[model samples]
Target chain A: MKKIDICLTPELLHLYELTDRIVVVVDILRATSCMTTALAHGVEKIIPVATLEECRALQAQGYISAAERDAKKADGFELDNSPFSYMQEHLKGKTIAMTTTNGTLAITRSREAIQVIIGSFLNKTAVVEYLRSQPHDVLILCAGWKGRVNLEDTLFAGAVVDELKDEFLIEDDATLGAHTIYGCAKYNMLKSMASSSHVKRLHRLNLARDIEFCIREDEYQVIPILQGNALVAMVKA
Target chain B: MKKIDICLTPELLHLYELTDRIVVVVDILRATSCMTTALAHGVEKIIPVATLEECRALQAQGYISAAERDAKKADGFELDNSPFSYMQEHLKGKTIAMTTTNGTLAITRSREAIQVIIGSFLNKTAVVEYLRSQPHDVLILCAGWKGRVNLEDTLFAGAVVDELKDEFLIEDDATLGAHTIYGCAKYNMLKSMASSSHVKRLHRLNLARDIEFCIREDEYQVIPILQGNALVAMVKA
Candidate 1:
């Protein structure tokens, strides 16, 4: 069986051997969810930059920009990291340059893996199906808040483990822990996440609608795979 | 109100502020359990060193050396990391020089904190009570397996969160995650840990007794607090 593991935060990514693994980078609160929604809603591709300046510079090259910092929209950006923002009718076929506090950094850092795929609850089934058909082991890299582990990302990783347990060997404590947590929270995820720091943070910023939208399972049947600095929809084999 | 946080691994310790907080370092599979057992069995003090060479050097100075690597006893050490070894009558009144793959490394790295204390299921109540009376915030530092998060340690950290939730503000997701994991595992911990990688590793090495002993609640009523380079039992007023 192929093996599955979870790197709880990008800061601890160095401890895991990234070679020969399919890295599923998840930032469920907004980043990956927005990317999934953008692709499914007909956006051409997303350029995930690590800094605001990098994202801003892309605008001069005709790329629409979306940037967020500390759970709020950055100044002068066309859009924040809300899934609803990506569904705009005017954005059809337009390429977006995006930068967020955690998700983009996670994508950039996972370049060493055999393949890096974006994962979130919005397109969770598509991600599981993609991994099921792949040959390499899987490492769910959670883009935790500011390099600290968060519940929403961990729960999404756990959902993947629960779906792929039969085909993948759960070899690490982190994987098993995620699976167990998912089992506990799958019934009432919003209630389970009531005490989550990210939920609280988003709630304080009046982004509860974004949280609800991000956690909605299988809302989009698309998988965003990182390809040469851009996240494009994976062509199903 | 005081606050409590769980640093899932020492590698992520940099993200947390350590000053003015009580750092409870736990390696529940054996290291912290052994230290608690030794201290409760009348061992004078324990000097936790990072490497085998340092522990071996202390042996020449009449300190009993205990060392472990990858769940096995290191060669040339006086004892392994099993809690049972610490219970031997001859160990009484002797200071120990100890090194382990995970636990001691956690202790050495947490030196920046205002207080560094050892925690284990063997001394869980003592650790909880001590933290209850302390004025500072608390950080439960798990000595994960070689800087990667492990279930046993994470569960122990969660146990602390569950017990102290009413008194401390859990403002982070890691702490809440741990607390939830503890709730899931507290009923039948061994069964909950049947899928844990560390549990499988220990069982493969015929160390089931050590795991059982280590997980026994309140087997020892001692809190080993670091003072200078030695861990001595805290004198309660």
Candidate 2:
């Protein structure tokens, strides 16, 4: 059996030997979720830029733009990082130039991996199905909040791990750690993590709805895969 | 009141503004714990080097040396990174040089902070008491396993937050996150985190006793403080 592991946070990355693995990048609240939703809702593709300047520059070439910072939609962009924003009919058939605080950085970091797929609760089943067909080792990259391991990303990784456990060998400590956290929080994830610093921050900013929305499982069937600098929906191979 | 927080892992570090806060480095498995035990048992000041070569050079200078990698004591060192090894009567009154994978790196990274202290469950009460008296903002630097967040450090940070909750306002998400984990683990910390990746790895290596020893609260009254290149017991002001 091939070794499959999850890096709970990007900082745990140094321990990973990523030469032959298929890396899945997850930022559940709300980068990957937004990307997955946008693609599922018929947005053409997403250009994930690491910075606002990159998003604006991409938008200058006439692409629609979406930007987010601190979990809220950035001003002057065509859209925000919220999944609700991506569910609009206007976004259908449009290409989005998107930038976020953490998720975009994770995608950029995993460019060296053989394959990089975006994983979120929004497209959990699709991502798992895609991984099941591939014979490569899997590495779930949790795009934790601003480089810190937060609850949502790890839980998403756990959700993936729960699905793939029978097929892959969990090799890393992070995978085990994330799974343990997920098992502990699965009953009432939002309430269990209510005191989480990220949750508290979101609550303070009046973004509690976003947290509740992000944790809903398998809401969409689209699997977003990285193609060069952009993420597009993967067609069945 | 200024915000005092500790990043339990480098991943969660992105949320912290490290410019002005005092960061106390803690890695109970077992760098900080070893350092506290060494100082408490009457060992003369200890030098924490980042690499084995640095430890070797200090060893050549007639200083007793210790080094650890991946939770195992380094080969050919007089002392391993275990707190048990440092509790020997022979270690008393002798200056020692030490190096480990995570804790030392944390200390080096936080060298620019206004002040740095070593914290562990063993010295919990003393550490909390000392932080309560300091005027500068406090940040707990959990020298996580390698560069990732580990359970013990975050649990210890939560203990600090729980202790200092009345005196300080926790502003960072990492702090809030640690407190949540602590709340979940407080009733039976060992059981709650018994399956943690690090703990399981330690158990597999037959180091379960070390985990139990490391989590014992208030076992040592000594609080380690960083001064010049060494961490010595803080002489209470």
Every candidate's chain B TM-score? 0.98, 0.95
Interface Cα RMSD for all candidates? 0.9, 3.8
The lowest-lDDT stretch of 10 consecutive residues in candidate 1 chain B is B174-183
lDDT of 1 by residue, B1-237 (tens): 999999988899999999999999999988999999999999989999999999988998888899999999999888998888988888888899999999999999999899999999989998999999989999999998988889999999999898999999989988888888888999999998878888999999999988888889997788999999999998888
Per residue, candidate 2 scores C-alpha lDDT tens digits across B176-199 of 656766777799988977756677
Error of 1 at B60 (Å): 2.9
C-alpha lDDT of residue B132 in model 2:
78
Could you estimate the TM-score for every candidate? 0.98, 0.87
TM-score of predicted chain A against the true chain A, for each candidate: 0.98, 0.94
lDDT (tens digit, per residue) of candidate 1 on A1-237 = 889999999998998999999999999998999999999999989999999999989987879999999999999989988899988999998999999999999999999999999999989898899899989999999999999999999999999999999998888888788778888999999999988988988999998898889899898898999899899999886
Q: What are the per-residue Cα lDDT tens digits for candidate 2 across A27-52? A: 88778888888898999889888899
Each prediction's RMSD to truth: 1.2, 3.1
Candidate 2 chain A has its poorest 10 consecutive residues by lDDT at A171-180
